[model samples]
Target: MNMEFTPDQLQRYHRQMILRELGAAGQQKISDAKVFIAGAGGLGSPAGYYLAAAGIGTLAIADNDLVELSNLQRQIAHNTERIGMLKSDSAQSTFKALNPEVNIISITQRIIAENVAELIRDFDIVVDCTDNFAVRYLLNDACVLMNKPLVSGAVAGFKGHLTTIIPGQGHCFRCIFEEMPPDAEEPSCRQAGVLGAFAGVIGAMQAMEVLKLVTGAGEPLKNTLLIYDGLKSEFRRVNAPRNKDCPVCGDDPYITIPGC
Candidate 1:
């Protein structure tokens, strides 16, 4: 990929380019990066929006769900007019309009273990905006095996959390939470009801994490978990250490075992 920026790109991204930490070199890095976003609902919507506007070279969005009336509350990227459209397709349309310079690819199928690795194989980084633990676990394991960076975020009710998982560099999700909790034990937004802007806040943070990872502008959430309580408007950062015996990222990683 050419690292040179065009006149149009320079003008479009002049503001960010002026930042001492993210000058032309950093902007070029962002322009040459490919990002894989896994789901296009509340978190994906805002995260993808910022990345699109920031001129991320290629953004591949994968989501199987179609937009619903309920999604409009926090899915700022989709509208009532796109209610029935596949979320990925809808997100593509919105992103393309926001920044025509970027390449936006949309995948409209459910992400399964069989296809997840191949889907994100070429991307530099993976962002987890998935709503369920099933897909999240699938991505966490796949990214660890593939040695890719994973930026994950989730929100429920008025609380949310995010963390950056750099395979071998920091903690993998499995090291933090050994197993997926039962769905009934952790209610979803539908039952718990998240505030709209709360999702936006966390999603935007995920976007910032992606940009930082791509440009090396700032320290990402590596080895740390950030929790946000919207009701109290507070943010907390806790140390996240990788467990040497973590099943997915341990010395004897389970990913190497076939069908274990």
Candidate 2:
């Protein structure tokens, strides 16, 4: 590998390069890695910014929504001035402003099962930042089928969940939830409400996990699920196991198509 950094990139990533766990080699890996973020909203906002700032080689962002004034509370990537723009486009602009060296591919369309695998095949890591269960499940299956590592997260009210899915190594989202809950009214960031800072905290954590994966700096959440209680400032983690009977990545595989 040609491990050369421009003076500007070195200055921008000086802090990361100085860290013992993430020195020049790890920094180089970060600068040569590719990641795909599946949403452009709250969770995706901070995650996208930090990943780009960290010099991830390429980022493929997909979102079919437009920025809304109401999204400002938690969607930090978009500002009032960009309200009429597509969410992915706005986020891409912010990412470019943060680090022009980061290659960004903005897909202003919703990802369906047919396109999910193709969209994910080229990326080394996948980040699940979507807000809905359908999209989440679809992403999980696609990543598993493609055999890529997935950094997943979800937040509602004052709590958030974080986990990484490594095919044949760790359990996937379906391993825990199995199936979507019946429409029994779950509080979402849009409905019940979420603290702006809470999103920042979780999103940053997700970004950290991605960088860790890219740089091989630390063990990822591979076989564990981390839950954050923002209101109480507590973090809890549970060990997860790959289910032998998991529908998508398991022995009897029922989710041949992406769950989306």
Candidate 3:
């Protein structure tokens, strides 16, 4: 891979390039990476921002929802002026303004079983920024089937959890949460009330994980779940070993195809 950098590129990524762990080579890797983010909401906002700012070559954001007044508190990528705009479009505008060098692709469609595979097929990494269990599970299954690395994060109330799934290497999201809970049992951010800044914390960490995976800078949170408690201001790591019987990424995997 070419490690050559134009003067402007070097100047833009000088601080990151200075790190012994991630020199010009790492920057080149990062610049060549294509990351697909599932949602353009709270988590996607910060994750997308940092990835674009870091000079990621291509960023694809998928979201069919429209921005609303209520989203501005946590969905930093969207503003009051962008109300009613497609979330993906709003995110594209924000990320482009932050770093015009980034190639941003906005997919204004809800990710579904029929299209999830095609949506993420070309990306090097997948970031789960979706809010609901259905979409989360869909993304997990798709990534596992495609043998792609996935960085998953979730936030509710004052707490947030994050994990990275590298297909055959470690546990996937399903290993930790075998199946999605019933709708009534699963509380939405609207019902539980999430702290805006708390979402930023987890989203930023997700972005960090992606950078690490791209540049090989530090350990990606393989098989480990990182939890943050905003009220206590503490972080904890839990072991998440792969489930040999996991339906999607197990010895006798049930989900052989992307949408199955």
lDDT of prediction 2: 0.88
Candidate 3: stretches off by over 4 Å: 184-187, 258-260
* Candidate numbers, best TM-score first, in rank order: 3, 2, 1
TM-score of 1: 0.95
Give, for candidate 3, the lowest lDDT window spanning 10 residues: 182-191
TM-scores of all predicted structures: 0.95, 0.95, 0.96
Backbone Cα, N, C clashes tallied per candidate: 0, 0, 0
Model 3 per-residue lDDT tens digits across residues 31-115: 8999999999889999999999999999999999999999999999999999999999999999999999999999987888898
Clash count (model 2, backbone only): 0
In candidate 2 the C-alpha lDDT for residue 56 amounts to: 93
Better of 2 and 3 by TM-score: 3
Quick one: best TM-score, which candidate? 3
Which residue ranges in model 2 land beyond 4 Å of their true spot?
184-187, 258-260
Worst 10 residues of 2 by lDDT: 183-192
The TM-score of candidate 3 is: 0.96
Shift of residue 14 alpha carbon in model 2, Å? 0.9
